[model samples]
Target: MQMEPIAIYLFVSALFILVILKIKTTNSSSKLPPGLWKLPIIGNLHQLAAGGPLIHKVLRDIAKKHGPLVHLQLGHVSTILVSSPEIAKQVMKTHDIVFASRSQPLSAKIISYDSANIGFAPYGDYWRQMRKICVLDLLSTKRVQSFRSLREEEFSGLATLLASHAGSPVNLTQMLHATMLGFTSRAAFGKKYQNQEKFISILCELLKVGTGFNIADFYPSIKWLQDITGLRTKLEKLHLEVDSLLDEIIDDHIADDNNNTSMHEDLVDVLLRVQNDRNYEITRNNIKAVILDMFAAGTDTSATTIDWTMAEMLKNPSALKKAQEEVRRVFSEKGYVDESNFDELKYLRAVIKETLRLHPPAPLLLPRLSRERCVIDGYEIPQKTQVLVNAWTIGRDSRYWEDAECFIAERFLDSSIDFNGNNFEYIPFGAGRRMCPGMSFGLANVELPLALFLYHFDWKLPNGMKHEDLDMSEVYFGVTVRRELNMHVIPIVSKPV
Candidate 1:
């Protein structure tokens, strides 16, 4: 007997509805966290649209109404939004292993070579091995410390350029970006490449694309939506262009090995030696992906930190005065600010800490995914639920901080809070197994450049501007967030070489 076509379609549709109904009825026993009432298909998405600010701000506002650990359902995805330190600790430390996996945004999948890199790779042996290599062999304090000469050399070049524009308002954004790129390039690729500008331009474009808060990430069930949205095609094109550049770079290094040139072994050299070993599964693509991570992680983050600290300092004259005085006093005694007396620059350290508290590099700290159903603070977090720790909101929560929004460098003077992930209330670099491996490298880039600029030059805002008049709007990008507007400052050569 031949089945009618209409009957076949109706039977299939009925099965789909029955499955969805079964899911809603069976799994509804678990007590989910506080959230807006869910509606079928697009649960609670309407609540998000009735917004003033989107993304982190929206989530923060939701937390105020719903509580620290609020649950939200968007399409088929289950989300746990964390906005308080106590709950953040419960998620990041108490059940670290359970929530160790990454959510794997669409942008990360394409750009990170299908989540092979450390930044986006799921929780597994691969992430462990990559992190071990990077932390111990590449970004260990010893390794980062060894590159002090390279950092100083790059700092000298930037200071020279800034000194040339003594009385004129100089472009702080461009100079800071260039210096950071120089540091990252020299550290990772053996030398600052001749085409550094072109490379940086591509990097900026990549970060812009990987913002991680787009439609492609939120709705993953419908494949054609991303296609019709054109995000997939655009990212693929960018990835190919970036891959081509890396191809030439790796080939050049391989050819350099063939020639046996006597040169300092940089990070690429270290990875090549590691890849040659048969003990590890370090593929060529792995080396390239890790290299990409180093460049991306190292460059913009340092620049953004410096930009924010400087802006914050300018806004609060007392902060600028105190920080400058500490650096100057140390310089006056030692004749130059070298790494030897790094311990004495307590105030400068405070300024940087305060800046981080207010403006974390990765504000939301990259969403985590739950591997199994778990109870955190009596709230049931379902398996495969996407988790986001609101680092920005937690940092400013009045419960942990006094005058949370104010830029008070001295706030950290007697406080034990640090960004090393040990302090739950202040986790800018995240915590547990998935914490950033390059924390030391990132901090070194920020500290040295910030020290050099403050020690050498006396800065003035454009056209005799008052500190309070300065605009400090931020633009959140892929891995880090930075000021939206460009900063201009006039440099007076205070301490001569």
Candidate 2:
């Protein structure tokens, strides 16, 4: 007897469901860590939906009940949320070799050429090579020093833009966004991007799509939603626009032909030269991937932190006043700030560090995938299980800090606790080999410009707006968390000391 089409479809669906359920049951029973209830198709979906800003709060609570290593089934995948610091250290340090692989996301694959870039690439020789390129050639201290002129130029532009809108309410978040993007473009391509504003707008939109929850990510069969809804088309168009911009920059270099081969080269030129040499598996797609990672992760996160730092300072007037006074005192007579002056600006560095403690760009570091079974906190984490460390919550853990929630730049003023991922207690850039390679470069991009802004101008809210009225609500746009309301302040030229 032949079955009807609809009946056959239902039968197949039911069979798949049974198979999945059976697998989940087996996994659940297999001496794995405990977790919240598993709903047949959605498993732990309700928990994620309910857990908001303090997703870690929920995870911590769950871990308390289930033990330190709690396994969660979000959609079709199994994820392990590690809340304890010991477990986090082990995953990031002890077994770094085995757990260094990044979970390959569909969006990251296309943009990063199947994780060829350092930020999301799996642990291997490819990642090692990318790190070498980023460090020795691109993001090294010497390389960053070479880009000082570019930074100074961008800071000048920032000052000019802020001055034009002085004495009136200005959206500083917007200014910082533009400034950080300008810095990245100059460093990466050796020239300021022509369409700076539009470029960032498009890239942010792409980041939203990349990090936003998608049905396709969990249920690939419904991938048609992304395409049918034109979301895919939108991303493709933006990708092409970015491609055109980079291509034009590449063309200019080619046209110049003799564009000073001896001088310090920008990231694009280096990557292109590497591709031409065919020394390794590097390709055009690989270059684009690295560039995209720099923009998506490096630019946005640095800018977001600067914006948050400013907002926090404005909220706490004393901190703002103190930071500005330090800057003015350090460079009272200097016409403009430079990287050399950065060493003397200690308080400004503190402000940036304190801001990161409260709002890490990625509250939860990118999920790590285990290559083999392991035991964490006396609980079993099976192979391929996704692991996420709550850096946001970790930063605020009172067990490790005094007045954890308070933004006191003084805490870092005399301390050696840096964000280069060494001190797990303050890991804005993450820890171990997977740590962010652009930390030094990214930090410099934030500091000098921010110090200059404060030194030159006195910031305040709009007329008739009280400090209490300044909105401090936060919003997460992919990896970077920003103020829900753009920070608007009036920048008044300070009386020269």
Candidate 3:
């Protein structure tokens, strides 16, 4: 009476097919917002063609047609794209408590340790505690300032690297990316992986998979396709890469535990000490998750910002000249810029602000999922719905800014408004409780290096390329959005001191 394995497999497959069919048949009604015609199960799959540029732009167009709060079915799931600032405020402010949770994919969950980290964790006590620890212990103003020497050391190296190839057009994007990777990796883990390129490549792959439009994310029934097509394999490779690096780092800490007596600290040291003491319900896995969050969220966002900032500056020479003038005038004859000089670099701050407005690293911010039914700007948003606020469109909204599309740093020179997520008009880092806990650390990472770059090097487009013709087209991979092309700038050493 023993059953054959083939028969059992067939029976399970049949059951799964029936379950999928039943679910598709049951939820076939058009309860969501108005969208293009859809087929059964696939919904808008054909419409969401490759690259997603048309979809990204069309979503805004649809919102304008349907309303500020527009809903579309990706597969079995419901997606709501919010464009108007009014609706964004409702979701992020009025219904903050209900919609603060993250709707991450399974791969994201595994890499992020079941959403235990702040960037991907669900809205609850665990997130609150982890975010608190990150802010107070690791990302505080004092902690960020303490890392000034690291920043200065890295900046000097970057300047020297650029100076070595002064006559040639250097790819600032790639160079800046390496600088940021080194800075964040060392500050977090006390050392950069020897294979910096491999480590970063894995990170890039993870971000790609996490943010890359997958047919399965919108449609639950087709999720098995992700496994069948080796998407899962890629994620596995990335996870193994990240995990191995972290494990090696942890081993190093244990080996050096008895004799290491450095007063100057890094994040790994703090987390290791906390883990050894068995304090605060945090285990080794949780520590790994937080460190992963720090690297993933911290490194890419900062690097993307620097890249975008430089791109924007290159496109607008007037702004670039103004910023350079301010930097050079302030730090004339100084070997290089440092944290102490940041306070006086007013125009540099404005330039970075303008860069953020036009190109927010996290254009949609992180997607927030609702735990309960809520109303955003009089539109009813049901429970378990995904909420997306287009900070990209919001930043370009003409109502809050004059010539919003232009890259003008002077707009902020006399204004008190900032991008700390407080002002609904400009929420680059987001606001409220879920605001990026690492804001200070991120800002310091951006400002000091930016000032030094402008002060030391006069930039120009490569091979007589006109600034007006430079490509501003973007390709969004994940939460981090980047320009479609790597920006190259010729650094003319301006009258050496």
lDDT of each structure?
0.83, 0.77, 0.78
**How do the candidates rank by lDDT, highest first?**
1, 3, 2
Clashes of each: 0, 0, 1
Could you tell which candidate, 1 or 3, scores higher by lDDT? 1
Stretch of 10 with least lDDT, candidate 3: 26-35
Off by over 4 Å in 3: 1-37, 192-198, 221-223, 258-263, 276-279, 333-335, 495-497
Best candidate (score: lDDT)? 1
Across residues 121-198, which tens digit of lDDT does each residue of candidate 3 receive? 888888887777777776877778778899889878988898888879988888888888888878876666566567
Off by over 4 Å in 2: 1-30, 53-68, 192-201, 220-233, 261-264, 276-279, 333-335, 495-497
Candidate 3 to truth, TM: 0.88
Could you give the candidate ranking by TM-score, starting with the highest?
1, 3, 2
Residue pairs in candidate 1 whose N, alpha carbon or C atoms collide under 3 angstroms: none
Q: Candidate 3's C-alpha lDDT?
A: 0.78
Give the TM-score comparing model 1 with the true structure, all chains together.
0.91
TM-score of each: 0.91, 0.88, 0.88
